[model samples]
Target: MRILILGGTGEASALVRGLAGSGHAVTLSLAGRTAAPKPEAVPTRIGGFGGPEGLARYLTENGVDRLVDATHPFAARISRNAAEAAAMAGVPLLAIRRPPWERQAADAWREVGSVPEAVAALGEAPLRAFLTVGRQELAAFAAAPQ
Candidate 1:
């Protein structure tokens, strides 16, 4: 079976390692955001697939038997594209989903579902915040003069 894994995180790397010598041809795909990504056990492809349609094209062209979305939890766009592309190309998709991180009593975290909500939650104070949002959503938080 030909498996194309959308990978970037440690779990994705671990998955690829676990599937080694499993009689499956696996290819890992990265977003090329990092200048130097750690090496993998299987063949690796770095870059985007344009969008859902482009991903579908790649899936069909490459004769991918299965697609595994092992991207970061924050990579919503990539996961969405993978789902749509899998449907479009008639390929099976396996998503490695991780449960939302449970906040410990000592953790100071405010979870917001949307960018606007995140901005609102930040309030108008000029305080520092450790944000884990995507690049597209970064601009929303730029309103903070801090």
Candidate 2:
């Protein structure tokens, strides 16, 4: 069976390595957000499939038997596109969703709607903040006085 994995995260890379020599033909797809992405064990494709329609077309044309969504949690658009495309192409789809971080007794967490909201939660005071929203969203926190 031919498998297409929508990948970018470390989990995706690990999955590709694990599937090596598994008999199934596997291909990993990256969104091309990084200038230089790490090589994968399986065949790799870069950039978007345009959207749901384009992805469906590619799945049909390439004869993909299965689809795996290993994209980042914040990549809502791509995830939706993958689901829609998988349905349209009549291909089986699987999602690798990571479990949420478990909070410890000493951990203090505040949930916010967006990056700006997260920044605003810091208040007007100049405080050191550690941003972990990913490389693409780093610029959004630049205006924060922290």
Candidate 3:
């Protein structure tokens, strides 16, 4: 059966590799939001699908028998779109999420309720900060007082 894997995460890449050399044909799609995407072991498509309509069209045109949403956990928009499109196209859909990293005893983690709270806690201390909160809140880091 032809499979379409909406992939951009490490789990996606590993899935592709694990399915590699198998008889099933797989097509992986990436959102192309990265300036430098890591290499892939399978065929890939880049960019958005315009919207649900476009996605349905693609699924119909490609004759995709199955869809696996292997995008990052935070990619809610694409996940919703994929679900909608798969339902609209009457295609089987599955979500393959990676297990989150477990904290080790040596790891010291601080949980903050909000972005502003985290920023406020930083206070006037001059220190380098790394923000990996995704692109939506990238400006928050820039706006933080140094």
Q: Each prediction's TM-score against the native? A: 0.79, 0.93, 0.78
TM-score winner: 2
**lDDT value, candidate 1, whole model:** 0.91
- lDDT at 38, model 1: 96
* RMSD to native, candidate 3: 2.9
Compose the digit string of candidate 2's lDDT tens values, residues 1-146. 99999999988999999898999999999999989999778889999999999999999999999999999988999999999999999999999999978879986788798888997898888977766587778887777777
Estimate every model's Cα lDDT from 0 to 1: 0.91, 0.91, 0.84
lDDT of 3 at 7: 89
> What tens digits encode model 1's per-residue C-alpha lDDT throughout 31-132?
999899999989999999999999999999999999999998889899999999999999999999988777788879988888889888988778788887
Model 3 per-residue lDDT tens digits across residues 27-127: 88999988788877678889999887788889999999999999988898999999999999999899987676678997655668877777776668686
Give candidate 3 misplaced runs (Cα > 4 Å). 100-122, 125-132
Candidate 1 — which residues are off by over 4 angstroms? 113-130, 134-146
lDDT of 2 at 81: 98
- The TM-score ranking, best first, is 2, 1, 3
Q: Give me the displacement of residue 67 in model 3, in angstroms.
A: 0.6
